[model samples]
Target chain A: MQQIINFFIKNSTKLLFLLLLVISFGLIIQTHTFHQSSFISSANGVTGYVYENVNNFKEYMHLKTENDALVLENAYLKSIAYNNTSVKDSVEIKNLMPAERQEYSIIVAKVIRNTFNTKENYLTIKGGDKQGIQSDMGVINSNGVIGIIEKTSKNYSTVQSILNVKSKINAKIKGSNHFGTLQWDGKNTGYVNLSDIPRLAEIYKGDTIVTGGISKIFPENIPIGVIEKAYTNETSNYFTISVRLFNDMTNLGYIYVIKNKDIEEINQLEAETKDE
Target chain B: MNSVAFSNIARFIALLIAQILIFNNIDLFGFINPFPYILFIILFPTDNNKPIFYLASFTLGIIVDMFENSGGIHAAASLILAFARPSILKFSFGISYQYHNLNIIKKVTKDIFTSLEVFGYITISVVIHHIVLFGLEFFRFNFIWEILLRTILTTVTTLLTCILILYLIKPSKK
Candidate 1:
């Protein structure tokens, strides 16, 4: 026993290093596998509560700025509502009967907790299941698509912000029919990358980008950004385009959760196709 | 209770509040968010009991997890830190971590080595927390490179933050 103890004492440093390495590696594997990280989902739910409380105070600090921005956005949208001249043809109206050319619904919610720092940014809105918000519900600011609902609790729901790397939306270059997948590049919160646009298309810097009606996450032709730069890749068929994101992801406050009455059918059809 | 106990509690609460509120909002270069809360974990006096140390760190970490919205990531990381801390302390003192001899912080020890050791251990553990966090949030192998980059960047930012916080949360003499 004494000899064993002596040997153990001498080799302890190597053992400690191995132990920490193993623990960390195990965490990496567990974290990498989705099945193992469900623990994280429940834990995030807990954080959901904590941020909900903390943001109550924190959100107030940004209230004046948010309120001012909200007012400006409200006025801007009001202008769009009254005058539809500059509004292009692609902005789809969901509730449009033949009698109504354009129709829309807007639900108001305040940003409780906003974390744009992480790669997967999240916004905790002061609305929830009871407030008619559910998972996969589309969210937007006056700028463009903010995010979709990732998790929902009783009084609050978390939106996957446009700044998140997990967020992807189909968008097209303004004036050109070519569309590409838009995703956050994980470098700048205010910018995202538009990939898969055909290189042959008439593309240049400063051209506007807008959402394609390809997905239910956002409506068609919603203004996304202006092309910051565009270049062809080794895979020569596509243009790797960079876009200056429309929304100021860092300072998101008041948002509208756009519940499309037809989204259920849209997602259902996609899910069936995916299964097939 | 001793003044140090109160100070420890105060430090814990202050660090938690700062991390969840202030640092959470900061995103420089996108992947970095330095967690200063572990400064509280690092500053607990060597004379403090191991159980209390573990309990305090775990509780603080759990509270943080509640805010990060990632399940068990914070708690698991804190517990991992707590579990590994004694071993780290043992390595610092160049001795075994038996309970009876635990208060032997009076002995002259490796000051520089200990600080770096603690920093390395805590940084690695926090990286574990974040890797679990971002990885789960984006469940795909395609994001492996991004996740690793984010963890590294965030760890660097957090370490700078931890060092700055250490300057503020000084150990009070009994």
Candidate 2:
């Protein structure tokens, strides 16, 4: 016991210095935005590399479930194709509208690192600038909307998950044309809040919410979530609605990146209008 | 309480207030703020327990960090300064350090060193502390030139302020 005390007394400065240094670093990364981002990106690269290997093994283990999903998607696509051809055959009798060319293209990417526990959660994807993935692009899965791209490195990119506190996307009811800002309250992982909705719009529980397409980042009518609950304050004329998200944000795997080809033109036109 | 402990406690409060309220807010040419609070660590009694010294320095640094909203950069830099204080004293004083083993802390305060030696000691400690503080704050290598320039400019300002304070509060030999 005496020996242990003596040793500690002799080298206490070095030990204390190390301990304090670590604590300081933790505080620095937590409080500062720039430091937080740089630390997260570097940490993302290392952790993403490790997760990729682990995900590969997990993917193999869940092969049967993945196969079933793919089969269902194939069946859905076949039925849509058949319906389109049948409609084309009756176009001569009924005045048919011409189909518009698609303005958005999707690039498939795998999530390597995803976090749902924090107030500001982000996901790391395997595709980056090299794969034409840029900042401000929208990310989605087959089921629903995910988030917008935040930053891209050489071979990896980070997406600001809709679960983040700083996230705000334009969303509206399916048929009512009532729009509001969608945001996460950082309480429940499965639910988000839609605020600034007008009290005059008729909204009910289980009403579908989709992207409002007010911004060029996401296309219109992308499924966001379903209304769980809604209320309006006595003093305020807007309703704050609770929405249950369609995506299980915590268990994400594959996602698609949406690139709008007309985004630049749209932005330029908006800028010109604003200048007037 | 003993005079040494009383003086140290008084100095800690005084320095912390000056650092947080005055020095932290003074931004000369946008980035040349001098940190005079480091004088507490520089003049900390050498005969004191090393662990206590480290803890005090870290606490002082954290308090300054909180006021500045700079996270932990100040705490980390001050801890490093405390750890390197002994070597700095040894290098600057040389044989005089061993000669005054009975009261090494007092000896350093009273010794009439040359201006160059005083300048060198202060320069080394201030430069190193600023480098670590700014390096961790920026945490990026792309702005290497900016970091170097800021470190040099801040070190010179801090060194002057510390040296002036040391001279003003010169320790009288008993």
Candidate 3:
């Protein structure tokens, strides 16, 4: 027993090194597999506070661009409001039906820290559970889709950017019902790849890609990007198309976190179906 | 000794700010981030308490990882480098490193070794750090090419930046 103690004392440094390595590897595995790097994430109070201060100081430089985007979005929203008023007048009685109400809510937020260079990129944005932000909510800008909220702290959240290799959002051609998965290959900041798009669908360069209805997280027909290139190998029945995102993901400021009001019901239904 | 402790603490804070604020934002070629932050592990005084070195390195790495949202890749890589630093020092400096008085940055300032040895030491340290970093990040054999490409490109940038910073902060030859 004394020899064992002596041995441990002799190799304590090596043992400590191995123990720390194990802890770090444990963190890596936990983060990658379960997406639960909560306490260590930048969304925590201290990092969030730091990023917020930096962003507050830096936010002025982006005001011109942010205002322009807001203006464009305002114009679009105004147009929609006008159209909706006309439709409401045409079907005043139909508007009373609870089943036809809007099912998504938008929570406006500003991105404090954004990184697109990493293999698995994440964005730290202002506002979190305090503002009703939650994990799995879809984040978007006036331009297009951004990413899903992966983890949320009380006052901040981290978004899994669409540029992340782990990100796979359900998307489809603007006019077609055929669906594909939009993913990043960790190569280009300007583009992402849309795969699993079957060959039977007539596709062309410049074809617009948008979020499909299949996802409960995002509303159907939310613009994603335009197809820059599409091709297929002889062995495969799918066409892999490259999409050019409208949002210059490298520079982001204001964004909207989408909350699906019917998500609980939809998820419960899906889970029940799976069990059956 | 007190000054050494103070400077080490100051370096820890200064490098963290430089890395998190300045270097992290500089993503050349859309992917390569110059990680001069590892200079902390590299330039930490030799013959210091080993367990304290390990813990300090891990803390620095984990903080960087938290900011970067890269899980524990940085911590793991930094720990490995910290664990292997003695061997690396020995390899670079030879028998001279065994002495308690050896300080790497001070030696560089004193011109005790050729530039080649300095370059070699930094390169080896940076390469090992980045390989484990990008390799664990991608975490797949299929991404071996991507891993290598990122490691090489990032290492060159990091090495250049680290050397520049080293010279910029080297103690005056009194």
| TM-score for each of the candidates | 0.71, 0.54, 0.93
Give interface RMSD, every candidate, in order.
6.0, 12.1, 1.2
> Deviation in angstroms for B145 in model 2?
44
Instruction: Give me the runs in candidate 3 sitting further than 4 Å from their true place.
Output: A35-39, A84-93, A96-101, A273-276, B112-115
- For residue A127, model 3's alpha carbon misses the true position, in angstroms, by 0.9
lDDT of 3 by residue, B58-150 (tens): 999999999998889999999999988888888887867767588666765445235677667778899999999998999989889989999
Query: Which ranges in model 1 have alpha carbons more than 4 Å from their true place?
Result: A1-53, A59-64, A81-104, A267-276, B1-18, B22-32, B39-63, B70-76, B96-100, B104-174
lDDT of candidate 2 vs native? 0.78
Fnat of the models, one by one?
0.26, 0.45, 0.70
How far in Å is the alpha carbon of B89 misplaced in model 3?
A: 1.4
Ranking by DockQ: 3, 1, 2
Which of the numbered candidates is closest to the native, going by highest lDDT? 3
Tell me the tens digit of each residue's lDDT in model 1 across A106-191: 57887777776655556777788778887777788887778888777777777777776667788998777887898886667778
Please name the candidate that would achieve the greatest DockQ relative to the true structure: 3
Order of candidates by TM-score, top first? 3, 1, 2
- RMSD to the true structure for each prediction, in A, is 7.0, 18.9, 2.4
For each candidate, the DockQ is 0.24, 0.17, 0.72
